[model samples]
Target: MAEPSKSSSPAEQPRWQSGTGLAVGMSLGTALGLTVLDNLAVGLSLGVAVGLGLDALQARGSSTAPPQAAPTTPGAV
Candidate 1:
């Protein structure tokens, strides 16, 4: 069996690049506003804010940091 590369999976890709959080949030917000809140402006704004927050959180986690050199002690090779 051939081993798959970790980078080859689409599921591993970061979602913030696609703005999925915002879209989902907006959709839910619109629905909620129409059905319960009865305020389109408030709902959309809240949705966008929530979506941005989620996107930022996801983007932060997805950021790639440079690899650090292994620490070596004076006696260690």
Candidate 2:
């Protein structure tokens, strides 16, 4: 039987790199503000603010996590 690989994959990218929350927040804020308020400037500003807020939150959450140990090969000293 073969052992499963322990290497990190692309899907394991850090939250900051992915920007998933920021993108969603910006899109939703802009869409709602524009359609309801009919103001592009206000809408975009709100969107950017929301995205930044989400990014900040993610950063804060990640900062408190314990550091990860470096990976080692099976036979390496």
Candidate 3:
């Protein structure tokens, strides 16, 4: 039987992209909240908290598999 493909699927993106997305979301949320509520400390704190939580969740979800080993050649020392 043919060996299965080792390539990662196109749908899977690097973990940093997800964290950056969460950071952007939090920044926007905080800006909106501050503009609407006139509170800097509350907005910043809430944004940081939400961003950290989302990053943690993303890390948890993506860590199921261990790192892959490098492929070896048949005759290389």
Candidate 4:
């Protein structure tokens, strides 16, 4: 039998994944906070927040995409 395709599985791919931006952001943020900021709580919180923010930004354009055309009504502006 042929082996399963690694690309189809998320766990197999090791490169920086677009879906993992939040995780990456959080880790980086936490690292920054712990070493430079010298605050565990702040570091963890900021890391999580940054991670969430990155996720949101990346997902912003995916769902609820902007309308292609402006309002058709004339003199409505």
Write down the TM-score of every candidate: 0.59, 0.56, 0.51, 0.52
How many clashes in each structure? 0, 0, 0, 0
Write the candidate numbers in order of decreasing TM-score.
1, 2, 4, 3
Cα lDDT, all candidates? 0.71, 0.71, 0.66, 0.67
List candidate 3 stretches off by more than 4 Å: 1-18, 65-77
lDDT over C-alpha atoms for residue 59 of model 2: 61
lDDT tens digits by residue: candidate 3, 1-77: 33553544324656556666468657966896789768877777777777877766666655644656666777769
Candidate 2 positional error at 65, Å: 2.8
Candidate 4: tens digits of C-alpha lDDT, residues 1-77 = 33443232334444565558678877887898889999878888888888878767755644445534433565556
Candidate 1 regions off by >4 Å?
1-17, 64-77
Candidate achieving higher TM-score, 1 or 2 = 1
Give candidate 4 regions above 4 Å deviation: 1-19, 64-77
Q: What TM-score does prediction 2 earn?
A: 0.56
Minimum summed lDDT over a 10-residue window in model 1 is located at 1-10
